[model samples]
Target: MKDLFDYCEFGDLKLNSRIVRTGLWESEREKTGNLTPEIYNRYENIAASGVGLIITELYSLYPRDVFSKYSNTTNYARFVREARDLTDLVHVYDVPIFAQLGMVQYSKKTEQNIAIDDVSIEDIRKIQTDMIMAAQKFDYGGFDGIQIGLGNYYFLSRFINPNFNSRKDRYGGSTLNRLKIVLEIIKVIKETTNLHINCRLNAFDGTTNGMTLTETIEVAKILEKYGADSLQITRPRSPQFFTRENKEKNPLIEASEQIIKNVNIPVILGGGATTQNQINEILNTTDIDYISMQRPFVADPSFLVDWQLEGNGETKCKTCNNCYWKKTSTCFINRSAKWDVKSEIPKKS
Candidate 1:
């Protein structure tokens, strides 16, 4: 019988295990969006820690956006060539890596701030072009896959959510029309590149008018129809962080199971899975192809190693969102050793 540690296939990409390290915001990018040594070391640690697949922190397709100071895009060829070193390093550990591409909103500090949902058709087209170009460059950089991040309330997610998108134009009004931007991106990538494309769909949002699971499920079907290699079912971030008492029973599981049953493509489920037993139960019972974790990995990069060896043990992560405040995504519980950058930078959350 196949276990979580066993090899599996996601479209053309091969994985050493079923545990996936979902994209976490690591504010460790260089000026030109090149992979910094710190970021490289992080990936190396994650790859060496026994996770099967790794999705890198979101990379900005349009670097000039206001929120893109940390993640930027410049000369694709040069950036890709330089980034090949990080890819080769992770590959050495037999872990497949995926590059996540997202668009950023302008910060209040920027003079000409623009909201993600307020973008015009031409701007949307430009974003699609940037995304396609980024995907091509990531393929050149030796990534096993590229993930279209329609989660975390990013540009793509804003468009996908009815609550955020109020436009009556082609990019809004209806769910399919709202999804036009991402669908176009997927089509272009499939037609133009060899890199396997994955999508992180925001299945639900906490707000009243936010996207619903049914609509997201429909989107997943269309994504599969349009040649997406895999679907990662995620949701918009909760306003409050998690704790041991309020861990919320894998909030994404029910919807993810629905998506897995509907889509032919593999579905990666990640929400509040902190224990090995929860992971095993999810994989064994549901049709969910894999389990992805973000905070747990932040709290312990060797989480998979510990889980596999011990069979079952609670993660040390308290879900205290403290590490999320740092640009480096440091765990506050173990902040001293892993992230010791002493700076006066104000915490985000």
Candidate 2:
């Protein structure tokens, strides 16, 4: 029987459990883009909480991008130094952490939100260079890996999607051509850094000519062949699209199962699970060994500790998605309460 708490290997990193804590907004950080005490405290709680792996909130590549305000930017001067401290804290508990790097839009000095088809060869090179540089910083800061955002509505996601990328250049037309940009990025990162490269990808975009499960599986195989250490399969609009009402038939489960069969790298079923039983069921019933949760962690960073102790625990997250809409790290429903790490419970502030 596969258990959620079983220690296992994800790529070269060993984890305490099958639960992967994936993050989004970092609204708790300082306005100056420095990691605050609150940020460190939250991470400490999560690192100690029994999560198998930790993928940090999005590290926006460009400061002026659309999601930059809601994410942690790599442009901060103290990023590497402060990130080193944060990684050290997580390492104390032997939890491997990955820095989630992504940008919603690509912008140069004058051009803002450049379309995928409009991006020049020069722009592609710049984007790749920026991503490589970010990976280098992450390695220097002691991250176990880096989660490249090829999922969701990020620029790279659109660039690789047929519906969005209409360029006649080498970056468009066929799946391989569209994927060449990401493949090139992955190759350089693999060669340059020791950090594991985990790509977050959409199982299907649900668009007319966009990425379907068939194409995504093909993409997964190519990534595995070229060198992605692991993959987290998500939808275009993930946690928001996955609510209690639609819990019975999560499309990601089937999509992930298919993708896993085609690739040798670790595959994580990202989002839509809320309880220990749910996670364990997915683990035993499917080939997916790892499960990634985001909003539940936002609700309570230490929820996994309770799940392990109780053995049948479910998350307190209402899935209200205030965190998603408001773009904050702290849960709206539990905003008034503070996490009491000592008690492993939420207390009224």
- Report the number of the highest-TM-score candidate: 2
Which stretch of 10 consecutive residues in model 1 shows the poorest summed lDDT?
A: 340-349
Tell me the TM-score of each prediction against the true structure.
Answer: 0.87, 0.96
Candidate that scores best on lDDT: 2
Question: Candidate 1's error at 117, in angstroms?
Answer: 6.3
Q: Estimate, for each residue in 277-298, the C-alpha lDDT of model 2 and write its tens digit.
A: 8888989998889999999988
- How many clashes (backbone atoms < 3 Å, residues ≥3 apart in a chain or on different chains) does model 1 have? 0
**Model 1: runs farther than 4 Å from truth?**
64-67, 70-78, 106-118, 238-241, 337-349
lDDT value, residue 154 of candidate 2: 92
**Cα lDDT listed for each candidate:** 0.74, 0.90
